[model samples]
Target chain A: LSINQVNEMEYEDFISTFGNVVEHCSLFAAAIWSQRPFHGVKQLHKTFCDFIDTLPKLGKEGILRSHPDLAGRIAERGLLTTESTKEQLAAELNTLTPEEKANLTRLNEAYKTKFGFPFVICARDNKKAAILSGLEARLENETEKEVIQGVEEVKKIAFYRLLDILQHEEAEKLIGGW
Target chain B: LSINQVNEMEYEDFISTFGNVVEHCSLFAAAIWSQRPFHGVKQLHKTFCDFIDTLPKLGKEGILRSHPDLAGRIAERGLLTTESTKEQLAAELNTLTPEEKANLTRLNEAYKTKFGFPFVICARDNKKAAILSGLEARLENETEKEVIQGVEEVKKIAFYRLLDILQHEEAEKLIGGW
Candidate 1:
C-alpha cells in the first residue's frame, strides 16, 4: 500500500494489515496507528521502534520474553508463529539428530539456569554448530552482560522480521549494488 | 544464577540482570520474578515465553519493533546495540561497497513504503548476494504472507542471539557426543 493508503487506514484496518509484523504484538501497530502518514517503511519502522524504546522496563521485558525457544517443545508441537516455524526449518532446527536435540535441550537448560532467561539468538544467522558453540561460550558471561547481549540479539531478530513483512526487494539491491 | 539465587534476588536486581534479554523490554523478567524455583533454563525460558504469549497484541508489537535495522543507518553509524553490531559484522554487512549501501537504502525505502516496516532478514544466515536476492524475490509476496515471513525471520535471529549470549559449550559436546 502507498503512504497515502496507509495514512488513511482505520485503526482496525491498519492493525489488521500490520499487526502480525511483530508476532503477537498488535498493540505496537495500534500504538503507531495514530502516527500515520509514514513517509515509507523506514518511517513506519522508526515510529514503531521509537515507541518500543519509550516503553517502561517491564513492558520491554514482557516483549522480550514473548519469543519461544529454538527447537523447543512449542516449536516441535508446531505452536510457534508461522514465521518462526519457517525460520527454524530454514535453519534445519526441524531436522536435528536425536543426539543433537538432546544436546540442545541440555545446553538450553544450562544457559537458562545461568542467565534466568532463554539463550536468545538469531538462529538463521547461524549453523547448528555455531549456535551450539555460542551457547557453550556465552554460559561464562555475568548476568548483566548476558541480559544486554540477549536484548541486542532480540533487536537483530526484530530488524529481520521487519524486513520480511515489508517485503523490501531492495535488501539485495542495497547489498549487491548490481 | 541458579534457581535458588534467582529466587533470592530482589526485584530490581532481577530486572537489572535479566531485563535486557528481550532488547529494551525488561518487564518480562519482572513479571516472572515471583515465579522462581525454575527447574532450569528451559523452564525459565518457558515461563518467560508463556507470559509473553499472554500479553496484549500491542505489547508484542512493541517488542518486535524494538530492533534496529540490519546494515541500516543505525548500524552504519555504529549506533546499534553491541549484539547487533557483532551479528551484522558476522554477516559482513559492515563491509558493503558504497554502491551496495546506496542500493540498500533504496530497497529499504521501497520496502517500508509498501509494508510500513523495515526489511528484516537473518544477515548471518545469508551472504550479501542471498540477502539481495531475497529482498528482490520477497517483494512479490502479498502483505499478509510477508508479515508471517518477516516474523519467522525475526525468530531465527533471536534464536541465534540467544545462543550468543548464553554461550553453552555443551554444543561441542553434543555435536561431538564426547
Candidate 2:
C-alpha cells in the first residue's frame, strides 16, 4: 500500500496491516497510529524507532525475546509468524543441513545463555552462513553491547517488514484502481 | 520456588521461570531482575505492579493487546500459552456452546473496535458467566475508563500467576529436598 493509503487507514485496518511490521509487537503500530499522517514510510519507520528507543532496557530485551530463534524450534515446527517465515526462507534458513543446523543451534544456545535473550539478526539481509558466523562471533560481546546490537538488528528486520507492506508496483497500482 | 529461591536465581533462570508472569510482556521479568533479592512474593509482586504503573498509556495498551481473548481463537486452536490454557479452562471457556462462542466473538470484536485492544479479564477468578457479563457491561465504558479497568485486570491475572509460582506444598518441599 502507498503512504497515502496507509495514512488514510482506520485504526483497526492500520494495525492488522502494519501491526506485524514489528513482529508480534503490534503495539508499535497501535501506539504510533496516534502520531499518524506520517510523511511517508520513512517517517513511520522513524516514529517506530523513536518509540522503541524510549523503551527501558528490560522492554527492549522483552522485544528481543519475542522473536523466534533463527532456524530454531518455531521454524522447525512451522509455527513462525508469516513475516518471519518469509524472511527465514529468503535467507535459506529452511535449507540448512542437519550438521549446519546443529552448529547454529549450539551457537544460538550459547548466545542466549550469555545474554538472556535470543540472538537476533536481520535474516533477510544475511544468508545462513552469515547468521551462523554472526551468532558465533557475537556470543563473545559484553551483554550491554550485545543487547544494543540485537535491538539494532530488530530495527533492520522491522524496516524490511515495513517495506514489504509499503511496496507498490505500477501493475499493482493499476490493479488497485480496478 | 520460595521467595528466597527467586531472589537468588541467575538472570536466565529467573527469566525462564518468571517471564510469563505478565503474559507475553516478559520484559517485566527481564527488567525487574535488577531490583532483585525481593523480600518475598508480595514484594516481587509489588515491584511488578510498580513497573507496570510506570508505563505510558500506549505501553499499557500494548501489554493488554498481547493477551488472547477469553474463549477466542487461541483457545479454539489449543494454541494458548500454557498459563492461558489453564486459566481459560478454569473459567470453563473451553466448554462453551457454539452459540455462546459466537456471542463472545461478536462482543470481543466490538470491544476491540471501540478500544483498539482486547477485552481482558482474569479468567481464573471468574467463570464463563462473569466473563460474558463483564465484557458486555465493560463494552459500554469510555475508552479511557476501560483501558484502566483492563490493565487492572491484567495486574490481577499477573498476581495469580505469581502465586502459582510461589505456591509450593509441604509434600513438594519434601520431594525437592530429596
The candidate that wins on lDDT is 2
Q: Top DockQ: which candidate number?
A: 2
Worst 10 residues of 2 chain A by lDDT: A169-178
Query: How well does candidate 1 score on lDDT at residue A59?
Result: 49
Interface RMSD of each: 8.3, 3.5
Against the true structure, what is model 1's DockQ? Answer: 0.09
Task: Give fnat (model 2).
Answer: 0.27
Per-residue alpha-carbon lDDT of model 2 for B1-178, expressed as tens digits? Answer: 7788878886657777988888766667867876877976667888898888877787777777778888877777888899999999999998888999999999999998888788999898899989999999999999889879988888888877887788556224433221
lDDT of 2 by residue, A34-140 (tens): 67688766677888888889887767876777678888877888989999999999999888999999999999888878887789999888999998888888998
* CA displacement after TM-score superposition, residue B104 of candidate 2 (Å): 12
lDDT of candidates 1 onward, in order: 0.65, 0.81
lDDT tens digits, residue span A53-162, model 1? 65544445445455567798778787888777776776788778999999999998887676556777776677788888888898889966776676666655555665
Residue runs of model 2 more than 4 Å from their true location after superposition: A1-16, A95-102, A170-178, B1-40, B65-150, B164-178
